[model samples]
Target: MKLEHVSKTIRHKVLFDDISFQIHKGLYRLTGKNGSGKSTLIRLLSGLSAFDNEKRLKLEGDVLFLDLNPIGLAPFSIKDNFYLLCKTYQVKLTPELEANVEAFFSDSYNDDYLHASVGTKLKLGLSLLLVKEWDYIFIDETLSTIDNDSLKIVAKQLVKLSKTSTIIYVFHNLSCLLLEQNSRILHIEGGKVREV
Candidate 1:
């Protein structure tokens, strides 16, 4: 996917101005200071929010965006939530998906939705979404809530998955996981985006 001549403005303050960038199929790490428009750029690139683009965004494939918010129905069983997500995205419950979820939830963790922590909920949501074949997967600070072990596991899994899907992991402060994954860096600052 390519974002050409992209710009965003809110409340009379310019967030980004006429920035052009291309998103390829690989792992990417997005970094910036607080309120630097990292999420805004993701929203624009992933078609979550409108851009002051004049229709300049050219998306090449279906995008799956997972932010800090745990995806799925809040008032449902874990199984039911997974099922609903799969149905919404038109994906099957493949073994890869099962493995992905298992990486986060051990054989011992409670399967109940209410009992699951934010990390577990996000993990389940991510696993269900990641199973699908998407052109780009933009994860914005969702993994930060997970415990260290699970984060490491998910990071490794994300690295593996990046070979097939374009994964964009965003953070306010850069993490070592990105370096370990050898992810390309996209930094947002001064109302501009640049590859570093």
Candidate 2:
């Protein structure tokens, strides 16, 4: 994916100007200070925002935008949500695979369905993403909520994704993960993006 001459303005001020970058096939971390418009850029690229003025967001091929708010609610049960997600992505989960989802999220705090808590819901969403195929995946600061074991699973999944899909993640915790430092880092300050 390449964003060429992309600019976003709000309230008569440009948040970012001519922000251009290309993400090759690999895991690239979008690192910058808070309020740098990182989230804005992610949302724009994900086609969830109309904030860009230049409208130069270009995607080469298939892209799966997985933000922190993974699954949208429809007043459905956990099983229904999981099945819907699978159907939307055209993925087939076997009976054993479905059982593991229940097993993975079961806890005393959670009900037998594992849909009682927000944490469990997030877990379900993460689990759903593991088996899907895509060309690119964008994750915006959602990994921090995962527990230790889940974090390990996420890291391994990301590494596996690097082989096929380009993974662009906006992360604050750069200490625990492995990524290429040569990747672009945009520093947002005072409503402007400066290459760092």
Stretches of candidate 2 off by over 4 Å are 54-62, 70-76, 95-115, 178-196
Error of 1 at 139 (Å): 0.6
Instruction: List, residue by residue over 51-97, the lDDT tens digit for candidate 1.
Output: 77545345667677888887756567676777777788888787776
All candidates: CA RMSD in angstroms? Answer: 2.5, 3.6
Tell me the number of clashing residue pairs for each predicted model.
Answer: 0, 0
Residues 68-185 of candidate 2: C-alpha lDDT, one tens digit per residue: 6647454666667777778887778888877766655555213433335655566666776566656877778777666766666666777777788777777687545444333345
Q: Which candidate number would show the highest lDDT if scored against the true structure?
A: 1
Q: Clashes in candidate 1: how many?
A: 0
Evaluated at residue 145, the lDDT of candidate 2 is: 67
